[model samples]
Target: MNNNEHLTKRRGMTAEDLLRLRSVRDPHYAPDGTRVVFVEKSIDEENQYRSHLYMWTKDGAVRPWTFGPWRDTKPRFSPNGETIAFLSDRSGRTQLWLLPTDGGEARQLTFFKNGVRDYVWSPDGTFLIALTTLGDDETIEDREEPEKAEVKRADLKPRVVERLYYKSDAAGFLDGKRAVLARIDALSGKIEALTGREEEIGSFAISPNGRTLAFVANRNEDPDTTFTRDIILLDLEKKTEMNLTNGCGTFASLGWSPDGMKLAAIGHDLAYLGATIHRLYVFELERQTKRVLTADWDAHLGDAMVGDTHADAKSPGPIWASDGSGLYVTASERGRVNVYFVSLDGPIAPVVEGDFHLYGFTVHPNGRQAVAAISSPTSIGDLYAVSLADGTKTRLTRANEALENEVVFADAKPFTYQSTDGWEIQGWIMKPPELGEGEKAPLVVEIHGGPHAMYGFTFFHEWQLLASRGYAVLFTNPRGSHGYGQSFVNAVRGDYGGMDYEDIMAGVNAALNRFDFIDKERLGVTGGSYGGFMTNWIVGHTDRFKAAVTQRSISNWLSFSGVSDIGYFFTKWEIGCDVWEDAERLWHHSPLKYVQNIRTPLLILHSERDYRCPIEQAEQLFIALKRLGRETKLVRFPDANHDLSRTGSPALRLERLRHIVGWFDHYLKGPFG
Candidate 1:
């Protein structure tokens, strides 16, 4: 009924109680199914991250294992039960360290200058295979010679060399063939270089017996093509290598089945964003045949996230139901991301349902209980545990409780409206709770990102925070959003701000007509990426919103095509050609086209390091608003990416929230006496 009640916290709030407040991620029961370990993260004074590992007794007692004295993390129990391997940067570099599960001194395993990037303990517990790289070898001459430099009088900026075609938002440019694979011997403290070739290991998985490794990488390949990683299988024992998934370059993944005979992974066929593909492949190594799992364009393969841990969906397969009658898989089917169990061979049916969509899921080791995160626009993901047999769902984590305790959630009512030419548009409306009998609530129209990404049950942490502040929030899936089908998501291809914009405003108008308490005079609008662009587009066309916040948005398509690394490709797919080929089309869809008609006060939130929607986009909009004498402000996060609001640096994510709320407080809810 209440937040504390929902939290299931039995007693007075202790430091442990506060620690429990942060959502726990990747909770796994040990092989014996006795103890549990998870990552507990929090932001400190500087808004920087300080994450520590905590161990839980099966009976409910909890203890901090890896110390937080210098930011310890990711504790994984070795199968043999002798040691727990984890990563800690206490040494000033992120490296692998091992702690004895039975209380012993934690010792350093590898001493590399560049550090161990990410590690996975081999099943046999013999070694921990790490994917890491040091900056390319540089000589004293390679280092800037301050004494011999031409620009010695002025400050020197580091020269960044982009090695490949497209760069990543998190890890920029592909560089000078510097990646290496290392296997740290658990017992000997010796490191063997498994890969020193002129390529970087992208994604990999170990063979069931732990004798072989399968991965995707670009070795001795082109440095110009954006997608260059080739899938290869290497024998750990023999140090021999063989190409597994060929021709399907740039990105590839491999999952070994329980029998070790079959591999299930998706090979890219013109993958956009190096992800978001329409096909999945199951390979029978012996028969040497590949089966296209799903050919439906609407269906997408969620991130593989291959781990040192066994692939749950393949081989050993979704914890057997005791009788081995069926297998469970959380997939996008019919219309939503659902959990379903198909007979080891046949029909599939939904295990969970509603308008919301499912993201991450984990099945209990015992095969009896399962926990998953379900969410929607207004609600962020809430942890829930369900019975594998009966399919009865029980909520676990009360993430929204504290916010809901002091404030009420506007009930998200779903309704459908007509788009311009009679196409039906569906959306949800939220009315602020605790509204006075006669007072009206201001409306906040929220647009979602991924123009192709769907809006469903999964929660949006920001939306709840907004609803808590007494604003009625409106969000809808436009013609280009997901959940309906393939055609719907791709509708905006080669054309954004066209029919999609029309579809979005139609839904907004429908919400206004349906809700009486919504104050049309005090409307506020906000969104990130595609949504932000729409927000900019909305203010350009209508003066309805008193204030607006455009986060990480694109203003001029011409600048976007050149400034954004992926701009060359995204603008290509979105508008059907390169910037030079479609200059007219680019200018036509750009939100800047309507800049002269804009009237509302606007605030732009951007991250300095965001490569997706570059900071320049925000700069463009801010300068435009300032030139027109519009009340506007720009909030910039120092080292965050496009994902800052979701999984950016902890401190930056917090600041992002504060800045958004602060801007609205000053404009939408403000001029406070």
Candidate 2:
């Protein structure tokens, strides 16, 4: 065979191939700094995700640490490095499990009625502190019941909803359960409730001395009314607590100094509502004062970098240097998630910089070495050992080497251009590989959700599927997108369909002008969440695109204000108006108002259980377009939330890809003719 024939033997990536690939995440370094362990997830034959633990060493090889048909995750090494603890559901219910470092049988740990949500190892490694939903089983047993039979009692039941926040996208309907902190004795297996309050803990961290715990919570009577989070320090010995951040704007990701004399966290002033970029702050425990550490950064701290397909993405807080020099943190800047070393004196320097997304990472105790879960447009996630001295990264695990070498993926080129208002915008374009001369591929303009989120350097399976189907994909970080300073992210607020719309159209224009292989006439656009909202708005405002797919989208802001989980506050914060205060203004910005102008063939995709954008949003759009004699269709995914495109069921995710590709090909590629 010739050399050119061997080069052309690679096949395009398909949905099935994407699903079969394993994903690695949550790299945690052992105390001795010799070993690292992370979670590896793969789709089973039943299309269910199965997670197992894998360990990596500096001079040794990467191998599986735990194995089973059931899922095991969240591995953490003990302080002494003699054992490892992780969460497992092998016993029908998720519980904590421990394994010896020298190799031994795994032992089940916590046995909570309601499974544990999160956990932490105490500094002394004598106890395992965890956050679990306080159960009502004891309270239910004491209640009077007319029928003792389970079948009779289950025949008829009316669910009562009292709280304003009764349902969530992640955890279906609320069961009047509150999250509480508890401590489990490592040796005795006795569990004790640590906090008696009913407030939900946002996050927590253990102090170096093991005498204190720093946590964030919303202690207000009606936490839904205001965006407030307060930090509290609990003395393990005295059982007393002190408020550190006393009801400031939303605060989280607490990190304690090595000496236990100070605390660090990332939060905002609530000045810009949801679009506010988080700033790092250091709190002096002795003086009871707090100072801003990265006030001038103008970027959001802690992983805002987005990737569509990921098994597990755990955000790592600031890792303090052992010598008390500074702390290491990952933040989104431009298009990359870079690790930065923040000095105690407030200077910040990058320890690792690249055009890739670091979803999960951990620093060694000595702080000179670290392991990161890195992913790029062309590559799925894999583990890499990074050196703090010279910012050099060494590949640690080849999780998807076969998939990487066999799949012919397109290359994403970064681009910059001026929008309509003289503002600089950043974006990327992926041209289909092996396109012949004098042949132009169809262009697909993909928008990211979080109108506040940027689109770059992240692995997106859906984009790859589209590119493999001979489509030129264009994604951009328009105004109101993060990673371009706080002002740009906040720019979409109060002007959802205005400047943001212009910025998107400007991106489409740039791709058409810069690339001669892009067939502008055969254009397709798709997005989910805020991106979905923009897709709806784009189709209503222009007829340039031939096909459009809007997933979990927003149509009418008036109905969304009352139906969606965050609609009430998000509307007031992002739209700058309430439903009653300014109904006309809300209707004016809604894409439903301009549905008559939508000439493009539209496909509306929504999850039935999505609480964030409610299925009503898509139903309303589909009905309006169909009634107006416009081309439209709706596909509903059952039992899935707003994350259907990313972390939904394996079967449904592949179906979603098929539906999207079918719709776009029917219009843009013209099999209909």
Candidate 3:
């Protein structure tokens, strides 16, 4: 049936519909701008996500380029536009694969034992630069062992912890492996190590002339203690390297200018530490000088819109214009992520502005056009052809057209209200599309993870699912959220449960006052990470919420200061004190201290492998509530990390949604459910 006819039979969106949703991301334009390639990811019957490459031409025709059950992502056209290179795990490990534009079977390019992490093509397209990890004692020349005997599961050696940054949320425990750079011949597939396994490489970019390489890394004696990310310049011919930034500040998303005379990056010094806004910087190669392009721009430089539907979104850094006039970048401002143009002289202008999130994009070689992956409240990301001169965007791909036709999504209505100290807070409310007139509906206050991240116009599946289930979903970008100026984004620091808490409660009040259809008495609250901390704080401080769910949360600041992967430095940076420096203050900020006051039925959801907040936080809260004879339950997800809500297994994500919705139905809806 045609989409027009299918729309007439539209049904309410369901949690299970997540499996049918396809996420389009990382659009890269061919050198000539005649074609664009992007990755389309969807869940298969096995509940595993399969990402395949899809190609779109200037004629508006879109077709699948690679049919792979495994993930095939980061498609980049060669400089000559002859072949497209991407990373794939179809070969057991993620390796670089190349597919000819003229038509041929894709060929694997790298055979590293651990597989490639990231790669970029050379300016001349003769070679490629790739990043791979190596053990402390392992050399780049070491070959993979052949047919090694499998050790018994119980015989595995215990992991000895040594470094402060020993484990990460999604990456698990570190094995003393450092990310190193390697050069691979495009044709012969020969690989040679360019950097040793001493320090881990962060982000790297090849010079336009193919003569130099600029990479971000902290080479200090104790890199763990400092947040300094120095840009190092490597001379390909001389085999010499020099620190470009000279330990000035933390920087990332490095890009070389077209003339190869300047390097553009996004970062900031520890002016605000963890809450620092990311600014654009251009370094003159010859003059050895750095210029901050967005020094006057108040909003954060990169995309900070929080959503769960996208994966591997490209960093919208400074994409140098072909004529060397300026560069294009995405910035978060007022609950929207849009592309902007920053000139060499310092003037910054918007290139793409709308109520949609530009998650990823690639500029055309001609510099006049770009292919962007844009999503909105009603759309689940699609490719668009954007004109750089006039900010005109033309829709190129309707990836989720079928899903849109089959299901009805609630429209997110944006609103602003005054919070603590008369600070303006931005928020959105999504009411069920089928809400009867004058009928009150249960309100679910959804809090975003990153206190630094903003809840914007992006298509959020979980919000839509809640709205479809006859719940009014209210989400707000309180203080400490990006997109609202630097002062606002940094306001939550050192005041975790203070003003931030007031801002959220004020948002809930604002929603109740503005929306007559919302039933304030049957209110529910849920959030993860920093949001989870806020959830715990909210329930402990007030009995207003009827139900609450905290995911991968923080219950005790003192315990979190040592247990989390980023606990040590993050505690000092955000809380303004370490465990030893001010234990009493940490305890005061902890939600566990006020657990006795929590009367709301709380549901604790956490991932077993979540090293960011650590599952211990949930354990502490669950045990405390259970000991107090309070109504609480703990739901643990096995083999998942802190990113379980966004990037977890398809089946597990659905299960999580079920648990959340079911809990709210029982507590908030009660007999009506």
Q: What is the C-alpha RMSD of each candidate to the true structure, in Å?
A: 6.1, 2.7, 2.2
TM-score of 2: 0.96
The deviation in Å at residue 637 for candidate 1 is 3.3
Find the 10 residues in a row with the least total lDDT in model 3: 140-149
In order, what lDDT does every prediction score?
Answer: 0.66, 0.85, 0.89
* Model 2, global lDDT: 0.85
For residues 1-673, could you state the per-residue lDDT of candidate 2 as single tens digits?
9744654888787988757778899988888898998999888888887899998987769989888788898999999999899998887667789999899999988766666778899998999888777644532112112333455655777878877777778888877777778788888878777785666787888898888888888888897686789888888889999888777777988888888898988888888888999888889888988888888777788777666666247778887888877788888988888889989885799988899888888988877788888889988889888898998988888898998889887878999988999999998999887667789999999888887777789788888888889999999988888898988899899999999999989999988999999997899999989989999999999999999999999999999999988887988888889999999999998999999999999999999999999999999899988999998999999999998877889899899989999999899987741
User: Number of the top candidate by lDDT?
Assistant: 3
TM-scores, all candidates, are: 0.83, 0.96, 0.97
Q: What lDDT tens digits, residue by residue, belong to model 3 across residues 1-673? A: 9744554477888999999989988888888889998999989888898999999988889999998579998999999999999999888778899999999999999877778889999999999999988887787666444444798888889888788788877678878889889999999988888998368687899998898988988888888888799999999889899998878899999998888898999999979998999999999979978899889888798889899897456655679999898889999998888999999875789989999898997899888888888999999999889898898988888888888977888899999999868999899999888787799999999998878888989999999999989999999998999998889989899999999898999999899999999987799999999999999999999999899999999999999989998998998888889977889999999999999999999999999989999999999999999999999999999999999998998888999999999999998887733
Residue ranges of candidate 2 with Cα displaced over 4 Å: 1-7, 136-153
Error of 2 at 543 (Å): 0.5
Better of 2 and 3 by TM-score: 3
- Show the lowest summed lDDT stretch of 10 residues, model 2: 138-147
